[model samples]
Target: MTITPLSDATWLAVAGPGRPASTTIGGWTLVGEVFNRHDPAVRQIPDDDPASYEKKMLARFWGRFIGVRLDGKGRLAALLRDPSGALDCLWWAQGPVTLVASQVPEWLARSAGAGWRINPARVEAALHDPYSTSGDLLIDGPAAVLPGAMVTLNDGIVSELWRPDWLARSAPALSDDEAAERLRDALDQVVAGVLKSGGVLAAEVSGGLDSSIVAATLARTEPDRVRLWLNAWGPDATADERPWVDLLAAHIGITATCQPRATGRLTLEMLTHLTLGIRPGLAAMDALHDADWARRFVAAGIDTVITGKGGDSMFIQPADAGVFVDFHRQRGWRAFLSRANIDLARWNERSVWTLIGAARRPRYTPAAIDDPNPLLRPRIHPEIARHPWLQGIDDLGPAKRRQILGLVQGCGLHGASFQTEVATVFHPLLAQPVTEVCLALPTPQLTLGRRDRALARRAFSDRLPDAITTRRSKGEMTAFYGHLIADGLDVLRPWLLDGRLAAMGLIDRDRGDVALTRESLAWRGGYVDIMTTAAIESWVRAWERRLPGG
Candidate 1:
């Protein structure tokens, strides 16, 4: 990808293929790839109020874009980022000169003159929380144009323009069946938009609700244009998902190419291909496998790779506490207690009072933090530790609000991090329209009968098999994470002992190694902490090699 500086106030980077449509409307110049809508006629560009023009545009538009309108004097009037934040927008400002680009490295490279060095604090934060920056590239203090907002750089003054809270609107009053039908239609539109890109579409089907729904919908709707790829973890692994994979594939009537689970230690050779700056935990490792699969798609003439990534966050069921509150508020104490007992039983809770206490807490909080690695907590920069990781949004329902905000602020960042150069990965479930409908769903519709993701299961139950639609437990990739540390002491000694992260005082080598050795079999957050720290070490090594004198 080439990052070309369009001007002091603007820059451009093209991903995948096709040129970004650029037009001069009125006295303003707008550049972006408009999907699901025609290029905004210059006449559509509001003459007196540029901010209103953005609102009007977003009210009617859908697609991944980074757009900026310039005044006749070549001054930036407004900058727009996609609502779903699918495309990354990295920008750094120095004095009056503000530089922006789609890729992080490009932004960093240009901002080097602005005294932008790798921040040890941010780097360590990335290791501790991969979803740090809410999926925006925030390692070096550059601001990302996150979803549902616009930035204006006029007269060297930068201001943010926020669009209305469209996603959090109440669902049209409809019965469960009607809601499901509506959801199915929205998903169809999102999938159809992805297919419009043309060429063969290959979906990742792990037999999970999200992937199964995507793969099944595509195969059922456009069987000729879609193919399925299942990452079967082979026979030795207990509780493999291939049975469900096979069941879904058989039901869809399309043969799925099962790619055996990836096995191998993280090799030095693989680290050499790592992208610069801190990436999400095990991102490079995940990319290694994705790239391999992408090659097969390329050979098969498939250009678009769709996955079920954002479905979990997007089609979120209301939080248990929120559910309890809703029941208590809408019905009576008896009803709330009835539902509360069911939840307690399902969760195997120790006490109903304890669940009740937790349910009473606020849904959104500045302190609703992640369980950071204990070892890493001491090393984290004090300021970073104290800073609020997630911002609170007021317009959304507690459950849907936090879920979508988490998606945009946290998991959404991972969307682009897992992409391969050969194939374009599309998360149809994460599309703005799709997610909007998901957030608008009535609470009961989403979690009816105390079932999680109930709306999704009901929406496409007809297209999916019972095994997939009814399964409660989510698929795990412990096998994959375990493989990273499968070699134990020898595999990570060199990197962990004296690598950049340890050298920066961000991690204690002896302690990390001991933790890894002590719990090699435990594929949980401890494993993630070790893997993420190691991935950061690998990234540091790659960046060091690219220095003027290594």
Candidate 2:
């Protein structure tokens, strides 16, 4: 652990290995990996005003980092988290003193003793949504400094340093070809920048357009640095992507290692023994595969694991009526009713009249909370915690609003293995430059009024295999997750039905019993929900055991 004093009454504490390296310039301290886009040496903050400093920093630097500036009296003046959310900065008041850290300090919680308690409301909110990126801390005391936002420590005033909607609205209008060219350049630059950092890099090539693009870019940038191209295949045909993986490897002239995903399937023991974080970090059922990969990377002396995680969100992959809505709003009725209408309708396999009606009355609904556990208690008004980006987006078209929401969802992509002890995980697609570029382009342009991520496909068409660039089908893990649930029922039954969540009034015993039965599991098919609930229950139990009496 490293503690750096930011002021007489405040300090920044970073725990665990690979703590971000800090650099001090003009009384402002930058913690984590940061690089100035224009001039690498220009790290000093010229402006004294917080707002001006924020503007300057946003315009100049691009990387995962946090900036903290102090007053002449050695008091913390302002702190800002980078837009990518690659680094975490959480703050909470400990009696009279304010504490800031990269994560929930376990020591502090232990010291608080009885005073520290889990925030049930926050936990319930998380359970209700599961996909929200509101960045609410699970414990009652602390609050996360959300990505692309800042805080005035002295006054406890928080404001936005970066706004996705503003960027979307202000993005310059560009032709399709122009957007593709700019996107290609941004991807190249971001990938190259990561490679320049130097590491025994490994990349997850999932045989999808996104991962393939990332792997291709890595090869194009510094092929020799990448030690492994890892791909996980499932037993079922839907989950088998080895053919695509082989094609990508052959195209890139690098041997790829394909492993069975079931090797790291979630087990009862794995759930109970999970390394707990501030909240439930196990976002996906297959997250254990990450831990397995981490061990392999560590044994092989790998320093970084690159992925194309944010590609779907950044490239606007969802096919929704919002696209047509945005076309009508931006390009006028004439354009929307003509080529745009036909294109969107044909892409979605819907009639022009249906598309017109959808455009006229577009619905931007959040994903429904679909927990199948009968014991799950009902809230008066259960809703996902609203993210900062979701606010002030009422004026935008549904597609743009959904695009921003996609970005919000992308913030939680890191999940459990966000910060591994040995190898760092890097998502080049989530870089600030790439995010901004994607946000700037209109939704129609992003999807080319046809397929998802059309612009991205165009951008990397030359570098990647035609099988990848033009490939429409994506590998599914439904069968893999289904098998996991079916196989683990022996442990999952008693674990969930008798777990902490049930005792805490979150799960209903009778309903849980019915939900876990073969009949119910087959009919409802809530395996994913059950897995999510089990993970959350495990997290709650883990933290409860950390209490003094526990």
Candidate 3:
């Protein structure tokens, strides 16, 4: 489980540490690299002077990489997800990434040999018994370990490994206007950062609550500076998002470029984009035009891009959460209910529901599901119950399920958004602030009974049209690209049918194809995973072609 994070532009590849406890499984070794950017205990060797001088000597024949930035989030560094903690994935994936994994396993693992000791029962027990128990126990190794056993117990790493960045710390207090100002300022910072880096800020205005608000708010700034990008597919390809971007740009009075899906130029680069985006789950399959457009934007003087990625997750109320809360309270009793736990209370009906729903499984950390190890990640929901890797495993439980879902969408984006900006910074609702508010809010406040996603609509009501703000059904960006599937599938079929897909080596492509045919584009089953896989496969081919030996 070697993790090598790549900075192509800087030409740096930082190979991180590995898990001290995990044993080998098949050809791949397991590593544990807990990347808790907020964890206070974790420390790095101070760099009064740096290392990596010798490794680059051999790399000199190829190229050069700058010094590694391990302490901060200044640049995009892939967090290693392997249980063993090594930087070998990059060598296999054929890229440069930091394998910043741990070198020690607090608990003992099953003995080596004996047909992979960690069984489905162990996987289930780990996921179910969420609460940590501290005493140690003798862990029976593989059948071979019937005699000798490794000491095992609830170790801190399990809890520490999955901890979300949200619970870390807090920002200084601010007034309502100040909070709004903070968001706006973050937007400007992203814009300026991009501009300074000779990059353009690609504002992904999905017409949904988050991006729409971001686009509208950004419009109030220097509209000309922000380039609007939309994934044009589904019911209305040419017509989709035309009016919103059109009206917003017109009203804001700036230069807004709408980069839609193009007929030609679909290839493997999208895979690179997916990896860069850190969202290989969906974008890796289709609608690569969005990422292609992003790369184009970068080439066109847009080094920094700003997106409203975590906005919806932040305001989980007024949607499903609101609905959940409404169920418990009658017409009048709603106002009287106070949280059984926390003292802080906010009267905003919308905000309450939004936060609660998004934080349904508060204890379940999204980080666990958002593993960087490709074999263990970019999971598909429909296939989760059926994945070969999941053989003999039981349900992950409701709380854990919620956390896993949140991470797939939330944490996955945390990494994937990088594809847009060579150096991307999510503004307005970064994960830190957003996840806090979301988790604090109770279930009742999150899902407003009648007014689903109301908080978002109300925020942007003045700016967006009723068509988008109040829309119920989400469209398919991939279905719109159905025009190409028939033809593209002709190109995609051979690859899909290839041994790489059939062998379930790169991914469980066989199951993925089955799900792709049945599921919608949004759900991991639907469009998201399909488009992602398509893009990644193509990219892998191209990446291979671009490799030095090739």
Judged by whole-model lDDT over C-alpha atoms, candidate 2 comes out at 0.75
lDDT of 3 at 50: 29
- Model 2: clashing residue pairs? 375-507, 375-508
How much does candidate 1 score in TM-score? 0.81
lDDT of each: 0.60, 0.75, 0.36
Q: If the candidates were sorted by their lDDT against the true structure, best first, what order would they fall in?
A: 2, 1, 3
| Candidate 1 local lDDT, 1-550, one digit each (tens) | 4454555645565655565556444434445534553333235446686566665566456666666676565655666676666666666666766566655454345435344446677776676666563444434545666566666655334334332243345346678888788778878877777777676777788778888898888886788887546455543545367778889889988787777765556666555454533343343456456566756776777777788777766666433545444444334557445764476336533366644554455553323434556435374475554112244445344555556554654333344343445666677787766766666665545766365677788889999998788886766776555656656547566767767777788777666665656353453346655666666677666545433343
Candidate order by TM-score, decreasing, is 2, 1, 3
Name the lDDT of candidate 3.
0.36
Best by lDDT: 2
Residues 1-550 of candidate 3 have per-residue lDDT tens digits of 3433332332322223332323222221223211221222122222241222212211121100111222233343222232111111211111343222111111111111122222222222212221100011002221110000111111211111212222211224444344444444443443333344333566666545567666766676556666544434334643376555565556545445655555563344433344331112232334455556656666665544567665554544223332333333323334434451111123334455443443353332223332222222233222212111122212222222342234334433433333533434444454332343333333233333244445445544666656666666543454455444443454454554462323334455555454434232233323323444454444344333333342
Name the runs in model 2 displaced over 4 angstroms.
2-20, 38-50, 95-97, 112-114, 264-266, 362-375, 380-385, 548-550
RMSD of candidates 1 onward, in order: 4.9, 3.4, 14.1
